[model samples]
Target: MIIKRYRVKSMNEAITRIKYELGREAVIISQRKVRKKGFLGFFSKKILEVTAAVNDPEEKNKYENSSTDSVENFKKVVNDKIRNQKRQSDFNYAQSVNLRSENNEALLKEVHQMKNMLDDMSKKSYDSLGKSKLELKLENMDINKKVIENIMNKVKEIQQDVEEKKKLKMVIGNMIKVEDKVLENAVVLVGPTGVGKTTTIAKIAGKMSLIEKKKVGLITIDTYRIGAVEQLRTYADIMNIPFKVVLNIKDMEKAIDSMKNCDIILIDTTGRSSKNKMQLSELRAFIDRINTKNIHLVISCTTKNRDIDTIVNGYKELNYNNVIITKLDETSTYGSILNIIDAAGKPVSFVTTGQNVPEDIEVMNSQKLTELVLGEDIIC
Candidate 1:
């Protein structure tokens, strides 16, 4: 049974509400006249109040069935929503997995391409694994790449069983030329500026004058720089040897004639810039005027391989037969020594180790210099 109350304007209205909502089987149990009042009883209205009751078992069963259907429908909707969300989540995961796989494949492809490119480059550059290793070792010693290439070519011609180091030594022995002769009659030192020619000449002069007691005389054509004449003159004064500063090429012959009484004459020329063709031409003219076979092109060991080539080529017109390496203590790399020797096609006559007079300079030891270039020993 169910009971409900209704407040309406009349009993008819209440009966109509009860019949529509509770069905016609509902019976009115009580009725009363009532008033709906607002605040302070100012807005009040008279209404009819009715109490209704129903006890239909069929209607009760219908209500229970409708509630069960609504609950089942809600559960179905929630389950569908959950299934849809799960499908979307699975799709996203699969997409991420596929993307990673594709990315990995792309990375692998790139790696293989790079490896193939490197392999191709190696095949084109190196003849064999042994040659590659040898080339790398030479490069570490700072030998010029072109020079090393030439060496490798020679190595390729030799028997493989000869052993790499021995083969390298043999090859270097053939390529490198050295003159054990220190000083010759009327020798001239010429090269680019700042290669220590003045000091080198001083050292050589000191050696000949003090140690060898050969009655050495010094002459200079390097009067371009400030105090050039005075510096050599000072050294000459210290050794009490004859010194001459030739202001012009015509004066060179007179200067040489003045030093004719000495056992050996060491001539120092101006350090010319390799780029200055005019200066180099003038130098060539000056050198051509001198009559001597012991013309040595003095170069610094600290000079770069390219610059050494430039300096050597720049002074090629001078017809220098022997080469002198200076500032041996200033650098560790000795490949330039070999490079300059090979490029000039001349023997290395002397190498100056330091600024010390007479002590730091020595005749070129081909075997030891080759070893230094091969990284077997350090230059001290």
Candidate 2:
């Protein structure tokens, strides 16, 4: 490997230098702040020192050449498989020529169903053209001006008068995305205190275990609160799910190991004050030990937009890409959802509508969220 170090003013500058000198394939090894020596090192300015590495020229060249060849080969193999399947299908049709009449009936039925769906969508699009009510409702709900404008501009292009509520919901839903499926075996929930992280964990664990039939395990790292551990333990006992408590990195690792057979392990982290950098950093250390991609930052929808921005900014260092907005029932206006989504640029995974565990929590869907924001009753 070719390794080199560069000193730069900022992370962006360091990255640019690494890419320029070591190529885009280079990997960042480590980075730290270092002070330059000036007059016996008494007075100096701090700069970022970044260490990066790249593979040897021969290995890099060979890997690059093989990548193109591999892609071409993969495409050829896929095409050949497709052609073989087509030929096999043709042979089967010739052998079963009498079945063609029944197959045509089935195909015609499917085509009619598809046409009906398309016509319904087209009518809905035409009904959604007059969005005056939507604009007024969004304004009353206190959604951000720019976000409202963007949604309006996009919706105005489709001149349809269908169910305005459903149309509006679709438009709003398009702005958010959710991870309804469990991709990672272990998931961690992090957020400020009183954001309902513990309860949310229980809700998710219950759903996965009861509804999805996944073997669920619960782990809590919220040792700071006096009753936090007991609370989660009680829930675990009621749900008949295995539970563990971790106070440090070693405990966390052991807890995770104990739940290795679990289909999904939900972790509850101690809430930290966003302003407290040391606490957030400490929490990050415990999370780093787990090495999971499913870290969700929980926030309350009732929080003011300014505080929401602060919380989102403070948690940025934790690198949380998914957000769960809780306490939706407590708030009248949900403009904060859009505000936080826009400001943080993170997709909301779930929204907790009430205090009811499992039942109250719903995977965020654009249409439902739009209805909630517009002060319309959500049927579900």
Candidate 3:
């Protein structure tokens, strides 16, 4: 039987390495407990050691015996090879321990260490004729462990970076403060399809009419959707506000002409997907017709960062003034916010938390945004 001793940082790493090197049939001979390190920032890590034994000797006899040997002779050859293997394995194990004791941590990262030691011991083994070659075996170990260590460190750094990203996502998500927002008496909510643009319009309209006591006029350029008119019509009806439905820029001009006397005109646009360039051009025409007092880009907080970039890029031709971050109540990943503000280069104006008419709207606060990013309690 052969015996070998291996040391590793953890018991799991050690056992996994042992199973990988020797087959599962290998038996452990002994184990030792490592002492703790002393003072001076020194505590020898609690290292564990295990000794394993394996069968050998059958291999040598197999080589010597004839091909037509009887069962008894074959059995003897198998046993001799097994014994020879066991003895060579033990000698290699002893040499590894002696070399390791000479202060060589170069082969100590668990798996690489075993491979290096095995490579040094394997090139000049006994010949197939059961005779020693006595050739040089330890001349060329071409492995550069330093490169491997560098790669391992880089992998660890990437893992830590991913962890930090996940933590930042949790810290700042769904937590923007909605203070009282100052309006220019007019605001345009622009975004891609299904981003709650019209509902956001109604939310702002309800707030303006009920809270600010402004005579809010609702304008819709959304004659495209089947119930787009009805949706705004329903919200305007609930708020007792006047509503206008315009199909094109000429119609928008007429609607503006009709509602020029109103205190605040909230324009509900067609929820065209940002990829539809033709519709975006049409909307650009409508926006250019009116004097931009408060051109706000309404965006969903739940959308991916790339999609937000696409939306921002598609809308940049219109030169919208500020941003409204909507659907904050639906998501918990806020990395998109940094991408939007930094990459899109747009300042945020308001935040919407829910579908409730007026109650869900909130004005943006910079300090509160910082606090949310830090996961700190909001200072009242």
Candidate 4:
């Protein structure tokens, strides 16, 4: 018999190669799991060591004539291969260790440089006795300085021996507000143009209809944007929910009446430029027909702090009750979330992390939001 061994990723791979090299009559003699021979033996990838053998008439005759000699020679050859593999592995391990040592030295140097830069910044920040290191950190996070002062002042009131990060989280949790209520009977989403109002509607509608099992209805008065109505309609169709298009106040009233049987109705209005008084007034007229108490002003997190103030103030006339912050994934700074809450005095109803429908939107959670704002972790 002729025998061979294979070190492969899986039994299937070994079997395929063995069959090709040792013929269809080949049979597995032994198999075991082994890691690559190296200093990082436990960390190395594990693979299958399969020994396969096949019947060979010529080899069988030679083996019978001098079976002992043949076996000894085979063992010698196997030992030689193993010894060479060990030598090669040792050489590779030495080279890897040397390279890693050099890399570690460079890494330590970079870390020292970073530490020096941070030390300089800390010294400069502390030049003002009014600001703590944590306060400076918050300012770097783009939180309004006034807001940071307010939060820090509040944090100083607590007398517990708590960690600074935890203290900040506690103070922020109490300071920021979020609306945790379920969707009202009639809800409307409005925002300035290009703030992802339509997509936010779909995300909310999807969660309500598919996840909450609510009899959800979708109505769009967003004819100003091309494909806006179709985009929402597609989401409605997929969810197998009722959908309608309203062109005027009369159309809006009729659409609401038709979906009166639905557990909740989600309305989508045309995005208006905050600068356009005429557009905002027109949107107000349409939503007035539904008389929704849950009108959420949608805004993008990527909006400049000043622009967010503009959008919020411009839409103030619409009497929106809550805020929906979208595109949280697109920006590095989260101060806008706290900024809007403080600026508008309206609790955030939801926050959208991406463009995905349903999956990317989260109903505002106070503790989680605080952690994210503090750079504890990326929720997305």
Candidate 5:
């Protein structure tokens, strides 16, 4: 084996050098962070030190040839032994053939009986295997007990030939629901802080204004957080839509009246801790004044199922009718999405997979949600 050490400014550079010089088969022996040379190391920069090894090609070739020769010799010996045994067996079988002819009827009957037994056993094993696989998939999904039971029962009602993934998709599609129409006038986005409410609002605003070519208006009641107003205002300016920040019911009413002629008005709300009843109540007061049918509860896909339950319940006063699950790309498991919607019994409106303003957002669909929950490979 040949070993070499590489020191570089970053791990990525070290890895690149190792791969380029040592080939893909090279193994990393050790790695560590080290400081560059400097006077007493006072102002030196940190760097990566990596030790890698690759087998010498000459030695590797020799070993491969030796193993290949041994395998060939073994195969030759086995084949000779088998040929000798076959000649002896054939001679012995010739002597027994006449005697076995008298018992052929009984032997055939026994063979038929054995084949029947094996067929029965195979059928039982196949059914057991399918059930076990289905159970394992459902167990890993972290679905609610009742939901799982319902799905299992539904699956039982399907044809046995249906694929497991198709059955799962059917069950999930029945459980997951999406809004029937695009969001319209006075859509208020509410959620806990750090849940991407502002970003979600911008995504929705951009989609309506840019894609649909609708006359969109942005109204933010998120004046509490520093830069909150500026963030939405910036997005509004980019989208070239009318924007307003209202502090009171009077101001909110005036903003709404000013943008009444617009196709749709997207409202951005200040995110508050769900535990803060006073803040929730204050938010509720503002939403009550809006008197709009479209109140979307924005929640992150990364949030814990328990915290999501609490957040949804806490924001009940807002009476959000729709849900927009954001940050789907950040989380691998989507059971929380099902858990949240199932617990809240609300339909999903839109889903955001990433931070890309309009491109990452999609109108929620039941089949897509099912694919996400069960994993993408399940369908493909």
Candidate 6:
């Protein structure tokens, strides 16, 4: 027998519906209750509770049959819900997969277009160069292997965009890492005046002393300048490193001899103007006396583009190992770097950004210089 309780506005209506659905033998009327919730609630609404039960043998057999049927019914309801969910999920998955395929195809097409455009550009430049070379050869009737090579190389270089130019710069520059062979015990800073040469020395000297815990010494070949030695002396005083005054090539020779035991000996140049060839020659003489592996050429980036060629031309006589561009924070344009790189036939060593001692200067390896030169176009 099955009994059920129900709440409704009218017990008679509920009982009538139950009897019709379950049959008179199945639904046996049990009890009723009238609810009252104060005067207002009672007057506003009517509510009643009804109870019913099943007692007939036919009804009992039907109930027993339904008990097993109930399980199957529940399973069917669950299966229907799962089927609906699976269908929705499959539809969503198919939509997503189709969208992804479309996006991939579009990306492939775009890449193909870019490649075609690049090939067309290359062909156009090569054809133009070939035509020009032919005209020049026929007009002049001069055939030199070097001249032909130069023409071809110029043509290739002209075909490159900003990103391609950066790669070419790296290949041409062959910029070396500063840390690749860190000179221990001694270093010499040689460059023209106003290129932040003294400050660069101080930066590296302080870094060696404070961070590397190496016993460092400072030597100055800037005796001609009024406060060059004093300025370096002051920085040395602050850092508590030994500072020595160099009078000539002889003095530099002896200074290195005396500081042979020191971990790092940073030599400061007079920051002599490269405009005066004599001054650069005098500094080169002093550098020749020292047995240093690398000589860093300090050049400020804020300088005018035209001045880059002049400065580099003046310093080329010394055959300095690398260029160190300084004052990057002070300039916006860097096209001069390209001009210098092309002319000097040398690579960059370090780049100094600010006036903060030791902390502001950094080694200008290939990647950083490429990014700074190429701006937004070079792939990160």
- Score candidate 4 by TM-score against the native: 0.64
Minimum summed lDDT over a 10-residue window in model 4 is located at 123-132
Give the winner by lDDT: 1 or 2. 1
lDDT tens digits, residue span 44-136, model 1:
777889999997677678767776776787788778877887788778778877887898799889999988977965754455464576788
In candidate 6, what are the lDDT values of residues 1-380, reduced to their tens digit?
66766666776787786687555765546655666568676665556667777666677678778966887888888898888888888888788778878987998899999889768666443344455423243223222333334433654655546554444444423422333347565566666677899999889888888998888888987888888888999999999988899897777778888887788788888766678888888878988888666676778776655677677788876777777778877755443454455556577667788999989977765655644543422211
Candidate 1 deviant stretches above 4 angstroms: 1-131
Local error of candidate 1 at residue 173 (angstroms): 2.0
Provide the TM-score for each candidate, comma-separated.
Answer: 0.65, 0.59, 0.52, 0.64, 0.62, 0.54
Candidate 6 accuracy as lDDT? 0.69
lDDT of 2: 0.83
Question: What's the residue-level lDDT of 174 in candidate 1?
Answer: 80
- Candidate 3 deviant stretches above 4 angstroms: 1-181, 374-380
Candidate 5 residue lDDT tens string, 279-298? 99999889988999899899
Scanning candidate 3 in windows of ten residues, the lowest lDDT window is 135-144
lDDT of each: 0.85, 0.83, 0.67, 0.85, 0.83, 0.69
lDDT of 4 at 254: 85
Q: Residues 278-356, candidate 4, lDDT per residue (tens digit)?
A: 9899888887888878899999878887887788899998999999988999877788788777767788988999988
Better of 4 and 6 by lDDT: 4
Best by TM-score: 1
* TM-score comparison, 1 vs 2, better candidate: 1
